[model samples]
Target: MNPAGDPFLEACSKTFEDQFSPLEVAGIGSFGIVFSATTKSKSHIDKLGTPQHRDASEGSGTQALQAVKLCLPGCPSGIKGSTSRLQAEIEAMRRVSKNTTPSVRHLFAELYAFNTSNEPWYSMEFILPGVTLQQVFDVASAASYPFPEEIVFHVADQAARAFQYLHDQCRFVCTDISQSNMMLRYPGKEVSVMPDLVLIDWSFWAEASDQTTTCAVRNLYNCLAPVFFDAGWRCSRRHDRDSCAASGVFHSC
Candidate 1:
Protein backbone atom coordinates (compact mmCIF):
# COMPACT_ATOMS: atom_id res chain seq x y z
CA MET A 1 0.00 0.00 0.00
CA ASN A 2 1.16 3.55 -0.76
CA PRO A 3 1.77 5.13 2.66
CA ALA A 4 1.47 8.66 1.34
CA GLY A 5 -1.98 7.87 -0.06
CA ASP A 6 -3.15 6.06 3.06
CA PRO A 7 -6.18 7.84 4.50
CA PHE A 8 -4.90 7.42 8.07
CA LEU A 9 -1.78 9.37 7.22
CA GLU A 10 -3.94 12.04 5.65
CA ALA A 11 -6.12 12.18 8.76
CA CYS A 12 -3.03 12.38 11.00
CA SER A 13 -1.59 15.15 8.82
CA LYS A 14 -4.80 17.11 9.22
CA THR A 15 -5.27 16.36 12.90
CA PHE A 16 -1.79 17.26 14.06
CA GLU A 17 -1.11 19.76 11.27
CA ASP A 18 -0.28 22.69 13.52
CA GLN A 19 1.75 20.78 16.09
CA PHE A 20 3.82 18.76 13.63
CA SER A 21 4.79 19.23 10.00
CA PRO A 22 6.71 17.59 7.19
CA LEU A 23 5.53 14.09 8.07
CA GLU A 24 7.73 11.73 6.11
CA VAL A 25 6.97 8.05 6.09
CA ALA A 26 9.83 6.31 7.87
CA GLY A 27 8.53 2.75 7.98
CA ILE A 28 5.33 0.79 7.49
CA GLY A 29 4.21 -2.23 9.46
CA SER A 30 1.15 -4.44 9.95
CA PHE A 31 -0.40 -2.31 12.70
CA GLY A 32 0.68 1.20 11.68
CA ILE A 33 2.93 3.58 9.77
CA VAL A 34 5.82 5.41 11.43
CA PHE A 35 6.43 9.01 10.35
CA SER A 36 9.59 10.99 10.95
CA ALA A 37 8.46 14.53 11.67
CA THR A 38 9.53 17.78 13.29
CA THR A 39 7.42 19.51 15.89
CA LYS A 40 6.51 22.98 14.58
CA SER A 41 7.23 24.65 17.92
CA LYS A 42 8.78 23.81 21.26
CA SER A 43 5.60 24.73 23.10
CA HIS A 44 3.96 21.51 21.94
CA ILE A 45 6.97 19.53 23.25
CA ASP A 46 7.05 21.52 26.45
CA LYS A 47 3.42 20.53 27.05
CA LEU A 48 4.47 16.89 27.04
CA GLY A 49 7.19 17.67 29.59
CA THR A 50 10.92 17.08 29.24
CA PRO A 51 12.04 13.84 27.65
CA GLN A 52 14.08 11.39 29.76
CA HIS A 53 17.38 11.09 27.92
CA ARG A 54 17.41 14.36 25.99
CA ASP A 55 18.71 17.70 27.18
CA ALA A 56 15.81 20.04 28.01
CA SER A 57 17.79 22.92 26.50
CA GLU A 58 18.76 21.18 23.25
CA GLY A 59 15.72 22.05 21.11
CA SER A 60 14.93 25.45 22.55
CA GLY A 61 15.63 27.34 19.34
CA THR A 62 14.92 24.84 16.58
CA GLN A 63 12.24 22.30 15.71
CA ALA A 64 12.87 18.91 17.27
CA LEU A 65 12.52 15.75 15.18
CA GLN A 66 10.45 12.84 16.46
CA ALA A 67 9.20 9.45 15.27
CA VAL A 68 5.42 9.26 15.23
CA LYS A 69 3.60 5.94 14.95
CA LEU A 70 0.04 6.32 13.68
CA CYS A 71 -2.33 3.41 13.91
CA LEU A 72 -3.97 2.07 10.77
CA PRO A 73 -7.62 3.08 10.37
CA GLY A 74 -8.56 -0.46 11.30
CA CYS A 75 -5.37 -1.97 12.68
CA PRO A 76 -4.32 -5.57 13.41
CA SER A 77 -7.31 -5.21 15.71
CA GLY A 78 -10.12 -2.65 15.56
CA ILE A 79 -9.69 1.06 16.46
CA LYS A 80 -10.42 0.60 20.18
CA GLY A 81 -7.94 -2.24 20.70
CA SER A 82 -5.33 -0.53 18.57
CA THR A 83 -5.50 2.63 20.64
CA SER A 84 -5.21 0.59 23.81
CA ARG A 85 -2.18 -1.23 22.39
CA LEU A 86 -0.44 2.03 21.50
CA GLN A 87 -1.13 3.39 24.99
CA ALA A 88 0.17 0.16 26.49
CA GLU A 89 3.33 0.42 24.41
CA ILE A 90 3.88 3.95 25.68
CA GLU A 91 3.28 2.84 29.26
CA ALA A 92 5.79 0.01 28.86
CA MET A 93 8.40 2.46 27.62
CA ARG A 94 7.66 4.79 30.50
CA ARG A 95 8.11 1.94 32.96
CA VAL A 96 11.51 1.17 31.46
CA SER A 97 12.46 4.82 31.54
CA LYS A 98 11.57 5.05 35.24
CA ASN A 99 13.22 1.84 36.46
CA THR A 100 16.08 1.15 34.05
CA THR A 101 19.73 1.70 34.98
CA PRO A 102 21.15 5.00 33.72
CA SER A 103 23.68 3.36 31.40
CA VAL A 104 21.09 1.06 29.81
CA ARG A 105 18.32 3.66 29.76
CA HIS A 106 19.60 5.01 26.46
CA LEU A 107 18.99 1.61 24.92
CA PHE A 108 15.26 2.34 24.97
CA ALA A 109 13.51 5.26 23.29
CA GLU A 110 11.83 7.94 25.37
CA LEU A 111 8.11 8.53 24.96
CA TYR A 112 7.38 12.15 24.18
CA ALA A 113 3.63 12.43 23.70
CA PHE A 114 0.56 10.44 22.69
CA ASN A 115 -3.11 10.85 21.91
CA THR A 116 -5.52 7.95 22.07
CA SER A 117 -8.67 10.08 22.16
CA ASN A 118 -8.55 11.05 18.50
CA GLU A 119 -6.39 9.79 15.65
CA PRO A 120 -4.55 7.35 17.89
CA TRP A 121 -0.81 7.85 17.75
CA TYR A 122 2.33 8.46 19.83
CA SER A 123 5.61 10.30 19.24
CA MET A 124 9.00 9.19 20.47
CA GLU A 125 12.67 10.13 20.35
CA PHE A 126 13.96 9.74 16.82
CA ILE A 127 17.25 7.91 16.66
CA LEU A 128 19.19 10.10 14.28
CA PRO A 129 22.23 8.88 12.32
CA GLY A 130 21.14 5.35 13.07
CA VAL A 131 20.66 2.16 11.07
CA THR A 132 18.99 -1.14 11.85
CA LEU A 133 21.22 -4.09 12.71
CA GLN A 134 19.77 -5.77 9.63
CA GLN A 135 20.95 -2.85 7.48
CA VAL A 136 24.43 -3.06 9.00
CA PHE A 137 24.60 -6.77 8.19
CA ASP A 138 23.43 -6.18 4.63
CA VAL A 139 26.12 -3.54 4.07
CA ALA A 140 28.80 -5.83 5.40
CA SER A 141 27.66 -8.64 3.12
CA ALA A 142 27.57 -6.36 0.08
CA ALA A 143 31.10 -5.11 0.72
CA SER A 144 32.32 -8.70 1.40
CA TYR A 145 33.71 -7.40 4.69
CA PRO A 146 33.62 -9.74 7.62
CA PHE A 147 31.23 -8.45 10.25
CA PRO A 148 33.35 -7.47 13.24
CA GLU A 149 33.33 -9.87 16.18
CA GLU A 150 33.66 -7.03 18.68
CA ILE A 151 30.56 -5.35 17.29
CA VAL A 152 28.59 -8.57 17.65
CA PHE A 153 29.70 -8.93 21.27
CA HIS A 154 29.03 -5.27 21.85
CA VAL A 155 25.44 -5.58 20.67
CA ALA A 156 24.97 -8.86 22.54
CA ASP A 157 26.18 -7.39 25.83
CA GLN A 158 24.01 -4.31 25.65
CA ALA A 159 20.95 -6.25 24.55
CA ALA A 160 21.44 -8.73 27.38
CA ARG A 161 21.46 -5.96 29.95
CA ALA A 162 18.33 -4.39 28.48
CA PHE A 163 16.53 -7.72 28.53
CA GLN A 164 17.55 -8.31 32.13
CA TYR A 165 16.07 -4.97 33.15
CA LEU A 166 12.84 -5.69 31.34
CA HIS A 167 12.55 -9.11 32.92
CA ASP A 168 13.68 -8.26 36.43
CA GLN A 169 12.22 -4.81 36.93
CA CYS A 170 9.27 -4.64 34.58
CA ARG A 171 8.30 -8.32 34.51
CA PHE A 172 8.07 -8.01 30.72
CA VAL A 173 9.28 -10.29 27.99
CA CYS A 174 10.11 -8.88 24.58
CA THR A 175 8.77 -11.66 22.44
CA ASP A 176 10.10 -10.25 19.20
CA ILE A 177 13.86 -9.84 19.41
CA SER A 178 15.39 -9.71 15.94
CA GLN A 179 18.04 -7.89 13.93
CA SER A 180 15.54 -5.61 12.17
CA ASN A 181 14.19 -4.41 15.53
CA MET A 182 17.68 -3.65 16.90
CA MET A 183 19.07 -0.25 15.93
CA LEU A 184 22.67 1.04 16.08
CA ARG A 185 22.97 4.74 16.87
CA TYR A 186 25.95 6.91 16.01
CA PRO A 187 25.70 9.58 18.72
CA GLY A 188 28.39 12.13 17.83
CA LYS A 189 29.04 14.52 14.94
CA GLU A 190 31.41 12.02 13.38
CA VAL A 191 30.09 8.50 12.83
CA SER A 192 31.76 6.08 15.19
CA VAL A 193 32.96 2.59 14.24
CA MET A 194 31.28 1.19 17.34
CA PRO A 195 27.74 2.46 17.75
CA ASP A 196 25.34 2.07 20.65
CA LEU A 197 22.55 -0.50 20.28
CA VAL A 198 18.96 0.57 20.84
CA LEU A 199 16.05 -1.85 20.92
CA ILE A 200 12.77 -0.80 19.29
CA ASP A 201 9.30 -2.14 18.42
CA TRP A 202 7.60 -3.25 21.62
CA SER A 203 4.28 -3.99 19.98
CA PHE A 204 4.54 -7.71 20.58
CA TRP A 205 6.02 -7.65 24.07
CA ALA A 206 4.25 -9.72 26.77
CA GLU A 207 4.33 -9.73 30.53
CA ALA A 208 6.58 -12.41 31.97
CA SER A 209 4.57 -15.24 33.51
CA ASP A 210 4.98 -18.64 35.06
CA GLN A 211 1.64 -19.79 33.63
CA THR A 212 1.45 -20.69 29.96
CA THR A 213 0.73 -17.69 27.80
CA THR A 214 -0.37 -18.00 24.22
CA CYS A 215 2.01 -16.22 21.86
CA ALA A 216 2.12 -15.73 18.14
CA VAL A 217 4.15 -18.85 17.66
CA ARG A 218 4.38 -18.50 13.91
CA ASN A 219 5.98 -15.08 14.13
CA LEU A 220 8.42 -16.24 16.82
CA TYR A 221 9.21 -19.80 15.68
CA ASN A 222 12.66 -19.15 14.28
CA CYS A 223 14.23 -17.21 17.14
CA LEU A 224 12.10 -18.55 19.99
CA ALA A 225 13.50 -20.66 22.78
CA PRO A 226 13.39 -24.45 22.33
CA VAL A 227 10.92 -24.79 25.23
CA PHE A 228 8.42 -22.53 23.43
CA PHE A 229 8.04 -25.24 20.80
CA ASP A 230 6.49 -27.58 23.36
CA ALA A 231 2.74 -27.89 23.44
CA GLY A 232 2.28 -25.96 26.70
CA TRP A 233 5.30 -23.96 27.61
CA ARG A 234 5.25 -21.11 30.12
CA CYS A 235 6.59 -17.66 29.27
CA SER A 236 9.73 -16.69 31.13
CA ARG A 237 12.85 -14.51 30.97
CA ARG A 238 14.73 -17.14 28.99
CA HIS A 239 12.41 -16.54 26.05
CA ASP A 240 13.95 -13.17 25.28
CA ARG A 241 17.49 -14.25 26.11
CA ASP A 242 17.33 -17.26 23.80
CA SER A 243 15.80 -15.19 21.03
CA CYS A 244 18.53 -12.53 21.42
CA ALA A 245 21.18 -15.24 21.33
CA ALA A 246 19.72 -16.83 18.21
CA SER A 247 19.37 -13.46 16.48
CA GLY A 248 22.98 -12.54 17.29
CA VAL A 249 24.28 -15.86 15.98
CA PHE A 250 22.11 -15.86 12.87
CA HIS A 251 22.93 -12.29 11.84
CA SER A 252 26.64 -12.21 12.70
CA CYS A 253 27.46 -15.30 10.60
Candidate 2:
Protein backbone atom coordinates (compact mmCIF):
# COMPACT_ATOMS: atom_id res chain seq x y z
CA MET A 1 0.00 0.00 0.00
CA ASN A 2 1.23 3.46 -0.78
CA PRO A 3 1.96 5.70 2.15
CA ALA A 4 -1.27 7.17 3.48
CA GLY A 5 0.62 10.46 3.61
CA ASP A 6 1.56 10.26 -0.08
CA PRO A 7 0.33 13.07 -2.36
CA PHE A 8 -1.35 10.56 -4.71
CA LEU A 9 -3.43 9.23 -1.87
CA GLU A 10 -4.27 12.81 -0.92
CA ALA A 11 -5.31 13.55 -4.49
CA CYS A 12 -7.56 10.52 -4.51
CA SER A 13 -8.90 11.63 -1.16
CA LYS A 14 -9.70 15.04 -2.61
CA THR A 15 -11.41 13.52 -5.66
CA PHE A 16 -13.55 11.47 -3.36
CA GLU A 17 -14.30 14.52 -1.26
CA ASP A 18 -15.25 16.63 -4.26
CA GLN A 19 -17.57 13.96 -5.58
CA PHE A 20 -19.14 12.72 -2.36
CA SER A 21 -18.87 15.88 -0.31
CA PRO A 22 -16.31 14.37 2.17
CA LEU A 23 -15.73 10.70 1.42
CA GLU A 24 -12.33 9.05 0.98
CA VAL A 25 -11.49 7.16 -2.20
CA ALA A 26 -10.68 3.57 -1.35
CA GLY A 27 -10.07 2.19 -4.83
CA ILE A 28 -10.88 2.58 -8.50
CA GLY A 29 -12.45 0.32 -11.20
CA SER A 30 -13.01 0.21 -14.93
CA PHE A 31 -16.41 1.80 -14.62
CA GLY A 32 -15.84 4.18 -11.67
CA ILE A 33 -13.86 5.05 -8.58
CA VAL A 34 -14.88 3.49 -5.22
CA PHE A 35 -14.92 5.59 -2.06
CA SER A 36 -15.42 4.49 1.54
CA ALA A 37 -16.96 6.46 4.40
CA THR A 38 -18.30 6.18 7.90
CA THR A 39 -21.90 6.74 6.80
CA LYS A 40 -21.90 6.73 3.01
CA SER A 41 -19.89 5.71 -0.09
CA LYS A 42 -19.49 6.97 -3.69
CA SER A 43 -17.92 6.04 -7.08
CA HIS A 44 -16.81 8.07 -10.10
CA ILE A 45 -17.52 7.19 -13.75
CA ASP A 46 -15.35 5.60 -16.44
CA LYS A 47 -15.73 3.35 -19.51
CA LEU A 48 -16.33 -0.39 -19.50
CA GLY A 49 -13.28 -2.40 -18.35
CA THR A 50 -11.64 0.96 -17.81
CA PRO A 51 -11.27 0.63 -14.06
CA GLN A 52 -7.57 0.10 -13.35
CA HIS A 53 -6.35 -2.36 -10.77
CA ARG A 54 -3.05 -2.87 -9.01
CA ASP A 55 -3.98 -6.34 -7.80
CA ALA A 56 -6.70 -9.00 -7.73
CA SER A 57 -7.98 -8.92 -4.14
CA GLU A 58 -10.71 -6.47 -5.22
CA GLY A 59 -13.04 -9.29 -6.26
CA SER A 60 -13.75 -11.16 -3.01
CA GLY A 61 -16.38 -10.69 -0.23
CA THR A 62 -19.45 -12.65 0.87
CA GLN A 63 -21.44 -9.94 2.66
CA ALA A 64 -22.54 -6.40 1.84
CA LEU A 65 -19.92 -4.85 4.14
CA GLN A 66 -17.40 -6.78 2.10
CA ALA A 67 -17.56 -5.00 -1.27
CA VAL A 68 -18.99 -2.33 -3.62
CA LYS A 69 -18.93 -1.24 -7.29
CA LEU A 70 -19.28 2.44 -8.13
CA CYS A 71 -20.57 3.11 -11.66
CA LEU A 72 -19.95 5.92 -14.09
CA PRO A 73 -22.74 8.13 -15.46
CA GLY A 74 -22.41 8.58 -19.21
CA CYS A 75 -20.89 6.19 -21.71
CA PRO A 76 -19.23 7.25 -24.93
CA SER A 77 -22.70 6.83 -26.49
CA GLY A 78 -20.84 5.22 -29.35
CA ILE A 79 -19.74 2.42 -27.03
CA LYS A 80 -22.58 1.85 -24.55
CA GLY A 81 -25.33 2.12 -27.22
CA SER A 82 -27.42 3.87 -24.57
CA THR A 83 -26.50 6.08 -21.64
CA SER A 84 -29.10 4.62 -19.29
CA ARG A 85 -27.51 1.15 -19.34
CA LEU A 86 -25.71 2.01 -16.13
CA GLN A 87 -28.89 3.28 -14.48
CA ALA A 88 -30.81 0.26 -15.73
CA GLU A 89 -28.12 -1.89 -14.17
CA ILE A 90 -28.60 -0.11 -10.87
CA GLU A 91 -32.32 -0.82 -10.95
CA ALA A 92 -31.69 -4.42 -11.94
CA MET A 93 -29.39 -4.73 -8.96
CA ARG A 94 -32.15 -3.49 -6.69
CA ARG A 95 -34.36 -6.29 -7.93
CA VAL A 96 -31.56 -8.81 -7.44
CA SER A 97 -30.85 -7.75 -3.87
CA LYS A 98 -34.51 -8.24 -2.99
CA ASN A 99 -34.88 -11.51 -4.86
CA THR A 100 -31.63 -13.16 -3.77
CA THR A 101 -31.92 -16.31 -1.65
CA PRO A 102 -29.53 -17.28 1.13
CA SER A 103 -27.91 -20.18 -0.70
CA VAL A 104 -26.60 -18.20 -3.65
CA ARG A 105 -23.65 -15.89 -3.63
CA HIS A 106 -25.04 -12.45 -4.39
CA LEU A 107 -23.40 -11.29 -7.59
CA PHE A 108 -23.64 -7.63 -6.63
CA ALA A 109 -22.64 -5.42 -3.75
CA GLU A 110 -25.64 -4.05 -1.87
CA LEU A 111 -26.39 -0.35 -2.17
CA TYR A 112 -26.45 1.18 1.29
CA ALA A 113 -26.99 4.75 0.16
CA PHE A 114 -26.16 6.65 -2.98
CA ASN A 115 -24.12 9.80 -3.43
CA THR A 116 -26.09 12.36 -5.40
CA SER A 117 -23.44 15.01 -4.89
CA ASN A 118 -22.37 14.72 -8.53
CA GLU A 119 -23.07 12.49 -11.53
CA PRO A 120 -24.58 9.29 -10.14
CA TRP A 121 -22.68 7.46 -7.44
CA TYR A 122 -23.90 4.87 -4.93
CA SER A 123 -22.34 3.36 -1.81
CA MET A 124 -22.18 -0.39 -1.28
CA GLU A 125 -20.45 -2.95 0.94
CA PHE A 126 -16.69 -3.54 0.84
CA ILE A 127 -15.24 -7.02 0.59
CA LEU A 128 -12.42 -7.51 3.09
CA PRO A 129 -9.45 -9.74 2.23
CA GLY A 130 -11.41 -11.23 -0.64
CA VAL A 131 -9.67 -12.23 -3.87
CA THR A 132 -10.97 -12.58 -7.42
CA LEU A 133 -10.91 -15.93 -9.25
CA GLN A 134 -8.93 -14.22 -11.96
CA GLN A 135 -6.14 -13.65 -9.51
CA VAL A 136 -6.19 -17.23 -8.32
CA PHE A 137 -6.24 -18.46 -11.89
CA ASP A 138 -3.25 -16.28 -12.69
CA VAL A 139 -1.30 -17.77 -9.83
CA ALA A 140 -2.34 -21.30 -10.73
CA SER A 141 -1.70 -20.86 -14.42
CA ALA A 142 1.57 -19.04 -13.90
CA ALA A 143 2.88 -21.71 -11.58
CA SER A 144 1.90 -24.33 -14.20
CA TYR A 145 0.14 -26.03 -11.35
CA PRO A 146 -2.85 -28.28 -11.68
CA PHE A 147 -5.51 -27.91 -9.00
CA PRO A 148 -6.40 -31.06 -7.14
CA GLU A 149 -9.67 -32.71 -8.13
CA GLU A 150 -11.10 -32.24 -4.66
CA ILE A 151 -10.39 -28.52 -4.61
CA VAL A 152 -11.79 -27.99 -8.09
CA PHE A 153 -14.99 -29.82 -7.12
CA HIS A 154 -15.34 -27.69 -4.05
CA VAL A 155 -14.98 -24.36 -5.79
CA ALA A 156 -17.03 -25.41 -8.81
CA ASP A 157 -19.91 -26.52 -6.59
CA GLN A 158 -20.14 -23.10 -5.03
CA ALA A 159 -20.20 -21.40 -8.40
CA ALA A 160 -22.84 -23.86 -9.65
CA ARG A 161 -25.01 -23.12 -6.66
CA ALA A 162 -24.80 -19.41 -7.34
CA PHE A 163 -25.73 -20.02 -10.98
CA GLN A 164 -28.65 -22.28 -10.15
CA TYR A 165 -30.01 -19.72 -7.72
CA LEU A 166 -29.89 -16.94 -10.26
CA HIS A 167 -31.56 -19.06 -12.90
CA ASP A 168 -34.21 -20.80 -10.82
CA GLN A 169 -35.11 -18.46 -7.98
CA CYS A 170 -34.44 -15.03 -9.42
CA ARG A 171 -35.40 -16.10 -12.96
CA PHE A 172 -32.35 -14.12 -13.99
CA VAL A 173 -29.45 -14.94 -16.28
CA CYS A 174 -26.01 -13.60 -15.62
CA THR A 175 -24.81 -12.14 -18.87
CA ASP A 176 -21.27 -12.25 -17.56
CA ILE A 177 -19.75 -15.28 -15.81
CA SER A 178 -16.00 -15.46 -15.89
CA GLN A 179 -12.94 -15.87 -13.71
CA SER A 180 -12.44 -12.13 -13.29
CA ASN A 181 -15.66 -11.62 -11.33
CA MET A 182 -15.58 -14.67 -9.01
CA MET A 183 -14.09 -14.00 -5.56
CA LEU A 184 -12.55 -16.01 -2.73
CA ARG A 185 -13.40 -15.45 0.92
CA TYR A 186 -11.24 -14.36 3.83
CA PRO A 187 -9.43 -17.32 5.30
CA GLY A 188 -10.20 -18.54 8.80
CA LYS A 189 -8.52 -21.31 10.75
CA GLU A 190 -11.67 -23.40 10.37
CA VAL A 191 -12.10 -22.55 6.71
CA SER A 192 -11.68 -25.44 4.33
CA VAL A 193 -8.41 -25.53 2.43
CA MET A 194 -10.64 -25.85 -0.58
CA PRO A 195 -11.09 -22.46 -2.25
CA ASP A 196 -14.46 -20.71 -1.98
CA LEU A 197 -15.92 -18.93 -4.98
CA VAL A 198 -18.33 -16.00 -4.81
CA LEU A 199 -20.00 -14.42 -7.77
CA ILE A 200 -19.57 -10.66 -8.15
CA ASP A 201 -20.37 -7.98 -10.73
CA TRP A 202 -23.93 -7.86 -12.10
CA SER A 203 -23.64 -5.19 -14.73
CA PHE A 204 -24.77 -7.66 -17.39
CA TRP A 205 -27.55 -9.48 -15.57
CA ALA A 206 -30.48 -10.50 -17.81
CA GLU A 207 -34.19 -10.30 -17.07
CA ALA A 208 -37.51 -11.11 -18.73
CA SER A 209 -37.82 -7.53 -19.87
CA ASP A 210 -34.62 -7.86 -21.85
CA GLN A 211 -35.01 -8.23 -25.58
CA THR A 212 -33.96 -11.35 -27.51
CA THR A 213 -31.11 -9.60 -29.19
CA THR A 214 -27.72 -11.05 -29.96
CA CYS A 215 -24.83 -9.56 -28.03
CA ALA A 216 -21.78 -9.32 -30.28
CA VAL A 217 -19.68 -7.30 -27.93
CA ARG A 218 -16.68 -9.25 -26.67
CA ASN A 219 -17.79 -8.90 -23.08
CA LEU A 220 -21.21 -10.46 -23.67
CA TYR A 221 -20.42 -12.77 -26.52
CA ASN A 222 -17.51 -14.82 -25.22
CA CYS A 223 -19.49 -16.64 -22.56
CA LEU A 224 -22.93 -16.37 -24.15
CA ALA A 225 -25.32 -19.27 -24.42
CA PRO A 226 -24.49 -21.42 -27.43
CA VAL A 227 -28.06 -20.83 -28.52
CA PHE A 228 -26.75 -17.37 -29.19
CA PHE A 229 -24.51 -18.71 -31.94
CA ASP A 230 -26.63 -21.30 -33.77
CA ALA A 231 -30.03 -19.77 -32.99
CA GLY A 232 -31.06 -23.43 -32.69
CA TRP A 233 -28.47 -24.47 -30.19
CA ARG A 234 -29.85 -27.63 -28.51
CA CYS A 235 -29.01 -27.06 -24.88
CA SER A 236 -30.44 -23.68 -23.99
CA ARG A 237 -28.55 -23.58 -20.69
CA ARG A 238 -25.33 -24.44 -22.47
CA HIS A 239 -23.29 -21.55 -21.10
CA ASP A 240 -23.36 -22.16 -17.36
CA ARG A 241 -24.08 -25.85 -17.67
CA ASP A 242 -21.09 -26.54 -19.84
CA SER A 243 -18.67 -24.46 -17.84
CA CYS A 244 -19.68 -26.14 -14.59
CA ALA A 245 -19.80 -29.52 -16.25
CA ALA A 246 -16.26 -29.14 -17.48
CA SER A 247 -15.09 -28.22 -14.03
CA GLY A 248 -16.94 -31.17 -12.57
CA VAL A 249 -15.35 -33.54 -15.02
CA PHE A 250 -11.96 -32.17 -14.14
CA HIS A 251 -12.64 -32.88 -10.48
CA SER A 252 -14.10 -36.37 -10.90
CA CYS A 253 -11.80 -39.38 -10.84
Across 38-101, the per-residue lDDT of candidate 2 in tens digits comes to 2122132211121221122234421123243345432234223322444555665666677876
| Least well predicted 10-residue stretch by lDDT in candidate 2 | 45-54
Q: Could you estimate the TM-score for every candidate?
A: 0.70, 0.55
Which stretches of candidate 1 lie above 4 Å from their native place? Answer: 1-8, 43-63, 74-76, 118-123, 188-193, 210-253
Clashing pairs in 1: none
On lDDT, the candidate that comes out on top is: 1
Candidate 2 TM-score versus the reference: 0.55
Steric clash pairs (candidate 2) = 29-51, 30-50, 30-51, 45-72, 66-126, 66-127, 67-125, 67-126, 67-127
Please count the clashing residue pairs in each candidate, in the order shown: 0, 9
